[model samples]
Target: MGIETYLVVTDLLCSREFPAEDGRSDLGIAGPGYHTAELATSRGTRVADASMREEVMERFHEEREALAGTLTEWWGEPSHMGLQTIRLRTATEEIPEPWARLSHLMGDVYVWEARQCGRWIVLGVADRDPTDEIQLLLTATETDPP
Candidate 1:
């Protein structure tokens, strides 16, 4: 995925027409959140060779930085929060919507919280399962859930 993924998702969010369906097309992705309460617009693209995990991770970081740059322009600086510890509890615990769901896949995430609007925007990369995909996902949720 590229920066366009971020742009498209942001457009979807701004329009309040989040991909309510689950599937992937070209660079567009929408699906159910790992936790049902949080509906994340997600996309998963498979790696051509699982052995290229290192290369994929390097690319994931590069893409993350690019997207983070755009996000900083829109949401201001973000807090780079660690999730390694949190990932431990995901299996035996129910932490938080996006966290609980994301923890299972990544060690950290970039979070931008627009507290005044009650929303949090998250960007993360996942390569935990080399056989699966090197994913870059943009997701959001309410700061205070109902």
Candidate 2:
């Protein structure tokens, strides 16, 4: 019903510990370095009130920052990628742009890579009004499966 935001992480051996409700079993398509886990949540569960849009956005920012901090602590600084880069890469691969339709709901989408550990982490936040529902996803993987 709503756009889902997926937080994807590649290459870190903790998939067994990920909760089952988070779609860890679905195991979406893997890219180059693929060993991953995913977690998802709906926007309604995040912001119950329509008037709290700003607060909800703030929370998203905090969550993203915390995730980045944790990853950095565990794996060190990350190589960052932007939406444009992702778009270009997808276009080059002839794959449909995953974020095209949900672009309006997105505030910031960050893709971070820890090459030394062969890991990739993606954090996408929905900054739209609370009335519009969205899904948040978190994933960890090794290489992109071809």
Candidate 3:
């Protein structure tokens, strides 16, 4: 919604320590137990024409890229990744809870391997509620929510 939101989330994402639970900090929130930190912005209701929908998607991508750039300064370049690729790669492995779940939710995901084994730094964008808002999620995951 604002630069501050992205800046704060970027700071949180850059932190080396993983969160103990799903919680809020700054304008966004973190999720180690659940998945990762997330932020959302509404593009008004989706009761619009196709061109307007396209505009919403484009804006979301720009926002995602902006945050992704900040993470890159700390995490280096992310692996431009997709769900099908991940699905195939993890076909023989047990994909982490929200990681698997994220694949279904995200339209775009840029991944950075964490310093901790089996953990990951992920930035995602998706309009889970197209009629309401588009969500930007940043996650560092090592646990599943109970």
Candidate 4:
């Protein structure tokens, strides 16, 4: 069996196949977050609809812009107070430090706060290689769960 990678946007997932080079092959990726299962084999990465993708993309852009400003401010100072209280237990173990670094290097990072009780920070890191763009996301645990 060969190692493989996939792409994800929302609940959808897709796998890529590449020509074998040397002993390995390269999988073309379109987005972050990967999943093994398929909604239907025939679908093979078929997007839900142009409208849905657009909506998500729009929200993503809005988020990107918002974070750009927030991160720029955050990077100026090592720390900043979060508006929401995030639960450590519910937090994902994999944090977006690398992405944050990339964002910082790129000149800004995007940060946001949950309305009720958590802080959500997202960092967009474009790979030096123009072909690849990745994002780093992070969240600071809150003392109290809101």
In terms of lDDT, which candidate is strongest? 3
Report each candidate's C-alpha RMSD, comma-separated, in the order given: 5.4, 7.6, 4.8, 15.8
- How do the residues 1-146 of candidate 4 rate in per-residue lDDT, one tens digit apiece? 11111112211221232122312112212122211121111121133455544454455445445545544553442324332222231254433332322323233333333323233333332222222222222322221212
Model 4 lDDT at residue 126: 27
Q: Which candidate is the best by TM-score?
A: 1
lDDT of candidate 1 at residue 46, scale 0 to 100: 57
- What's the lDDT for all of these models? 0.61, 0.45, 0.64, 0.30
Model 1 misplacement above 4 A? 14-51, 115-117, 143-146
Pick by TM-score: 2 or 4, better one: 2
Clashing pairs in 1: none
Residue by residue across 1-113, what tens digits does model 1's lDDT show? 34775676655553343345556533334344321111222234353554456666777778788988998888899988877778776667667555665777767778887
Residue 41 lDDT in candidate 3: 57
Q: List the candidate 2 regions with Cα displacement exceeding 4 Å.
A: 1-50, 84-93, 96-107, 115-117, 128-131, 134-136, 141-146
Q: Which of the two candidates, 1 or 4, achieves a greater TM-score against the reference?
A: 1
Least accurate 10 contiguous residues by lDDT in model 2: 1-10
C-alpha TM-scores of all predictions: 0.69, 0.50, 0.67, 0.26
lDDT tens digits by residue: candidate 3, 1-146 = 56577666655555546556656655455555444555665455468776776787778788888888877876689887766554554567777656666775675588876553455677777665456566677776655311
How would you encode candidate 2's per-residue C-alpha lDDT over 46-117 as one tens digit per residue?
Answer: 547655655655665666666666666756676543444444445456432234322344545555555654
Clashing pairs in 4: 67-110, 71-109, 85-117, 85-118
